[model samples]
Target: MSVIGKMLTLLRGSARELGESVVDANATRIYEQEIIDARNAILKAKSELTGVMAKEMQSAREIERIRAEALRLEDLALEALGKGKEALAEEVAVKIAETEQQLEEQSRVHADYALQVGKLKDLIKSAEAKVREHEREVAIARTTESVYKATRSISDNIGASGSKLLNARESLDRIKRRHEELADRMAAAESLDKETGTRALEIKLAEAGIGGDAERARRVMERIRARKTDAEGQ
Candidate 1:
């Protein structure tokens, strides 16, 4: 194919795919609409079937009327023959034959109507059964779609919550590390202060001649001086 033709084909494919995607997305709605359409069709068929049945009944009534007329004519022909009227009886017999023929034709028509009505009824029944099954399937599809949406929402929320929990845990860990570092610094500072304070107090005592080897040396020197002066005086 030429480039333009290929491009057109690609566009057509993409369009088809897009259409299918949209249809799939709204499949449940479409199925429900289809069920409604099927029900409407069944109702229309039933109405038509009712008309056919009415015609069949009318045909049956016509047949009965013809049969009654034939019976009445037969009785009239019998009375005419009993009264010695051959021509009138012959005329009555012709009417009886005509009525019988009419009855036969009406009965055939009625039978045909009855057959059509039966077939239509069976077809309508089967169509209704199929529609009912489709309705049930649509119901199940709707329920399943709802369940899938709920599950998807829950899964999305769980994923988001999991991320948030991870962030919170990291923040907690950082806080703990900072607190531990601060505690260490404070402990080091406290130890250094104690060492510095003790050294400063010892230096002050030594300068005031109050505590250590220097004071003991001064006392020994004073005792030696006193003994020498006593020996010279004696």
Candidate 2:
């Protein structure tokens, strides 16, 4: 294809894709709206069917009236014949024939109306059932979509928390390592002080004859001697 033709084709394809995307995003809402439309259509059809049924009833009533009139005419004709009025009976017979013909026509009309009503009722019933089925499917789809979204959100939150937890663990490890290092340093400092400064002080005191078991024993002997001297003076 030429460049311009290819461009047009690409544009059309893009448009179609965009339309499909929009449709997919609003699929549940669209599905619900379609069901509503179907229900409305069924309601309208039912209304029409009601009208047809009314016509059928009217036709049936008309047929009944005609049959009643025909029966009355037959009775009148029999009475005239019993009374020897041949001409009057013949006139009544003509009317009976006309009434019967009208009854036939009205019956046909009633039959047609009845047939139409039956077919319409069946169609409406089928349509309603189909719409109901579609509605159920839409409900299922919506629930599934909601659950999927909730699950995905939970998964994302867990992923984020996992990262934060890892960071926290690393921070704790660093803090522990620092504390351990500080404790080791403190221990080393105490050991050095005991080894160097404390030993030096001990040596100094010992050279002055003031910090040993021998010095303690000498002090004790002097105190005992002083006490004995005081006792003699008393």
Candidate 3:
């Protein structure tokens, strides 16, 4: 491939990887937000279902009222016929027919609305179940994500602490070596203290004002001599 083509290909690959990383980082938040949106949808559906149910209830009452009116009209028509009033009976018959027709029509509408209510309720119930399942799954996902992040953090710490650990180990070894060297020197000093000529050497070294002042040692020696002289004189 040409250099330009290769560069373009590399750029595309980099972009794709970047996009994927961005998506992965935000995936949990996106999923949580999506669950929230779904819950909102459920609420909206429930609201709509409530409206449908209310309308269904109104339709039921309407059907009941229509049936009652039709029964009253039937009784009026029968009474008028029994009274030997032909014109009145005819008018009551017309009213009865109209009422019956309306009752039939309203009955059909009421049944349709009843069916609709049932279907909506079932649909809402199913949606609610699905939402609950998603909620559980999202919770699991979140927990799993947390665990993964924690593990990743620990791994990163362990990896990055390599240099610090190495340095600390080297420091400890150096301290141990130094301690051993100091122990050897202390042992040598003790050995020197046991030597036959070491006391005369230490006196000379002390008189040179190395570890303590020669003037202080002379003053201490003078006090001891004076006490001896006083005892001898007594």
Predicted model with the maximum TM-score: 2
lDDT of 3 by residue, 9-51 (tens): 5446754444323224364577667777777877887888888
lDDT of 1: 0.76
Model 2: per-residue lDDT, tens digit, 63-179? 888888988899999999999999999999988888888888898899899999999999899889878876775665555446556666776798878753357788999999999
Lowest summed lDDT over 10 consecutive residues: which window, candidate 1? 16-25
Count of backbone collisions in candidate 2: 0
What does candidate 1's lDDT look like per residue over 1-234, in tens digits? Answer: 443453345446754444323224365577678778878888988998989989998998888888888888999999999999999999999888888888888888998998999888888888787777667655654554465566667767988787533577889999999999999999998878766877666777788887776788888999999999999999
Q: What is the clash count for each candidate, in the order shown? A: 0, 0, 0
Q: What is the lDDT of residue 9 in candidate 2?
A: 58
Of models 2 and 3, which has the larger lDDT?
A: 2
> Which ranges in model 2 have alpha carbons more than 4 Å from their true place?
1-23, 26-30, 163-234
